[model samples]
Target: MAVSRPTILIPSFNTGPLLLETVEAALATGYPVRVVIDGSTDGSETLLEDLTATDNQLRVHILPQNQGKGAAVLFGLEKSLEDGFTHALAMDADGQHPADSVTAFLELSSRHPEAAIFGRPVFDDSAPALRVNGRKISNFWANLETLGWGIDDSLFGMRLYPIRKLIETLEETRFARRFDFDPEVAVRLAWKGVPIVNLPTPVRYIDPEDGGVSQFRYLRDNTLLTWMHFRLMIGFLIRSPWLGMRGENPLLHLSPPAR
Candidate 1:
């Protein structure tokens, strides 16, 4: 029999257009997967209900009101823990993540069985001119705020998280919601001694014809990130030499499987 795989959790809100492809991609990992629907007023919930009925490995959780993405993810993580899963992989419902690359990512986890596999996205030309350029700005600020700790791509959404540590972190900390979740969780995990293994995976941005729907509120989310780094920078300043001395991205030189 195939090894029982780790559960995949997708937190979706109004991702109806992308849900089918996303869930299919998650299931293609040859693992059990689930989607947590956070107050989706759209037909997305109905669509997932149908999907759940047919696939024994697929499950859905529907909430009555829309909580933030962090809340949705937390619910999924709790369920995974209850089900005795050791890790959870999170992907955006959008097609930004390459389902094909997922095998390489999961393989690494299977080997290491200890490290967090993080995706350092290799962007394609199909990517938005503005978002692409804008994220570079966020990357720079995040690296500097960490005092050049060497995070390859700070804003990439695809990441594998260690379940127990992630649960504890989420319980103790605030502000892993919205766009800030990507960077904040990575940085905090680093602080807690969870080694980050970066993998260079190609990231594609499907166009509208491919059912692309982006809900990123640039102004609002950017403001949140700026504030987040403001706090990180202050902490860095107080412990500058210490944090700078801390090593990061040590695994970047290795051309391991793409996350």
Candidate 2:
């Protein structure tokens, strides 16, 4: 196997000034950073043009129109793969994800290259109660679908994925291309027998006054999740037997060597 080469991938959509901040922080981790502008009409991609020119560590890819978060990420993954990146640490550009944790997650990925490193969000008061509580519904179904494969938080977007395995998982379904991306991918990857590792990471919700923008529509997203889980339940019923006997990935049978 080739040596693990990881890149920080941020998918942004109309995140305004926060986009620059997120990109800068990711670059600060000394990793190659790629940002996919998901058809943002706010002139946000232009904000990084000058910086991207001067900094070899940063690159920006713009889409003609908004295709949703998952589509944006899939674009990044395809490019990253061509760039020879073995893994990708994906985080949000809306200032909710902690960029400082980039090194930790990447380090964990380096140690366990075949496993998925997920961020188990530690939310502060800045996080909205309704949103936090609402995610529980999705999490419950995700765990059940995977036969309790240890998905600490299904909706958290700050996670590191092996580029190849993730692409394969995404190719298996076309519906994870929008708001349903995060949770659906997690559950499906678990079903594929990818080992999961979760680490506690702080998540902060920025206020609008501070240039924080949220694309979440409570009713619409929740409905999407409901439909997503309904489909996953049917899949689970079909896969549970195989998943139970599978136990774990053979790559995970041995302990990771200490760093």
Candidate 3:
């Protein structure tokens, strides 16, 4: 059996100062943390200069140009694989995801090493109503596309994935390399019959005064998601028969890991 070496992965694109804070918190979890600088022009990667030099636990990879969140994550995953990591917990560089919850998620992944462990966000008042409500639409479609598979939150970025499974899933598709990454990956993983594990983690929307940088563009991103679901829906239709046999709670099946 291959031993699991799980790492916290933060993909940043012009995330400004929050990138440093996020990396620091992740490093504090005592797990190796990898940051992918996705062609960020804001020089945000510079913020981690000191730590990267001093800390062996933190490693940063830079892309020549911005390639979207999904691309950044894919880059990180490839590096993680090369570095012998078996799993990656992906979180946004923005301050929304809680750093303290990293240990719990990794611990859970340790026990259920073959499952995709998702963070079901417990939102505070800081969460924007539109963003909160918008995700419900994505969640609904995600569940439907998976034939009612258990997916607590489809668009949550803070999720743990078995590195190889996730890479194989991404390699089979090209559409999820941008804003559609989160939801699309979740739905596709379900179709592949990976077990679902959801844990409630508190999420905060950092105020602008606190140096929060949001890259989300409502119309552009939403249209991308709509198209993504449309494609997924078609794929789901073709595979529903197999997916249906996976049962309501696929985790209970717990098939042996891939060779």
Q: lDDT at 136 for candidate 3?
A: 89
Give the least accurate 10-residue stretch of model 3, judged by summed lDDT.
250-259
- Candidates 1 and 2 compared: the better one by lDDT is 2
Clashes of each: 0, 0, 2
Q: Is candidate 1 or candidate 2 better by TM-score?
A: 2
Candidate 3: C-alpha lDDT: 0.89
Of candidate 2, the 10-residue stretch with the lowest lDDT total is 250-259
Query: Positional deviation of 152 in candidate 2, in angstroms?
Result: 0.3
Q: Candidate 1 — which residues are off by over 4 angstroms?
A: 1-5, 239-259
List, residue by residue over 1-259, the lDDT tens digit for candidate 2.
5789999999999999999989988888889999999999999988898888999988799999999999999999999999999999999999889888988898878888989988888889999999888888888888889977788799999999999999999999998999999999999999999988887889999999878899999889989999999999999999888999978544433323211
Candidate 3 per-residue lDDT over residues 193-241, each given as its tens digit? 8888888889999988989889999999999999998999899899988
Q: For model 1, how does the per-residue alpha-carbon lDDT over 126-233 read when each residue is reduced to its tens digit?
A: 988898778777777666766554466788877777788788877767778666778777666665556667778888887777678777897898888889888766
Model 2, position 210: C-alpha lDDT score:
79
Residue pairs clashing, model 3:
39-65, 39-66
Model 1 residue 14 distance off true place after TM-score fit, in angstroms? 0.7
> Cα lDDT for residue 188, model 1?
67
- Full-model lDDT for every candidate: 0.76, 0.89, 0.89
lDDT computed for candidate 2:
0.89
